[model samples]
Target: MKKTTILDLVSRKLAPFMLLFGLYLLSYGHMSPGGGFQGGVVIASGVILLFVAQGVGTTASLFPFRTLSLVEAAAFLLLLAAGLAGLAAGAGFLGNPMAGVDVRAVPRVSMILVYNVLIGLKVGAGISFVCMYLFREGR
Candidate 1:
């Protein structure tokens, strides 16, 4: 009946640190080795830990399937929109379109960071949802 065991306690304590690390990876992906997909999986693993430690029902309550879907959709749209922005700027897709412009806000570094964050959030939610559903189906 009790889900709050020592393992759960440890997971709870450790999850935040894992999440922070994942965010760090996403933010610093361009500068470092890791990137969006990697950080996303890390974050998803943290969520999966919570799901296992707290049980599917509890995890679902905190991060519902519908919410995950929304996050994924939003992230995807934003990522696409980002590419579309480059196209609109007449630099094709993902190319430096704003080079002739101010080059302050739409710089390459900032775009990469934004892309990484979006991709990280999207993949994290997608993988976590997959894990939860699989566990629910007894697979």
Candidate 2:
């Protein structure tokens, strides 16, 4: 596939904004409609755009398969650990650990925020890894 200078330049300029939007959605998901899954998809879309515009090799160098795999796995494990922590704390599975604490002491949505961040990371890494693998196979 031949790369065009225009495509490369546009993608380079636009991808950062897409990633920033994704982060915004992830961080404010508890208060808004968008959440981890939406944010992750947005992030993956940005990577995919770069992959198509710059070619898979260049994108892969920036986001290596090994690192993506590790991130996905680590995020998954952490999410599970969070759930287990809730269970061990007698809140049941996926329950909030701060349930008994005073509302004034901590934010009620703190756990949701953690979950959103982890899920966003997991979904973004998993999707990007899959897309990269497919692009590699197509080569």
- Candidate No. with top TM-score: 2
- For residue 84, give model 2's deviation from the true position in Å: 0.8
Error of model 2, residue 21, in angstroms: 0.6
Error of 1 at 58 (Å): 1.1
lDDT of 1 by residue, 12-118 (tens): 89988988899889999999988999999999998898887878888788889899989988999999998888899988897665665786546657878878999
Q: How does each model score on lDDT?
A: 0.86, 0.91
Question: For residues 56-111, could you state the per-residue lDDT of candidate 2 as single tens digits?
Answer: 88888899889999999999999999999899878999999878667786797899
**41 Cα displacement, candidate 2 (Å):** 0.7
Candidate 2 — which residues are off by over 4 angstroms?
103-105, 137-139
TM-score of each: 0.88, 0.93
Quote model 1's TM-score.
Answer: 0.88
Look at candidate 1 and give me any clashing residue pairs: none
Report the poorest 10 consecutive residues by lDDT, candidate 1. Answer: 99-108
The TM-score of candidate 2 is 0.93
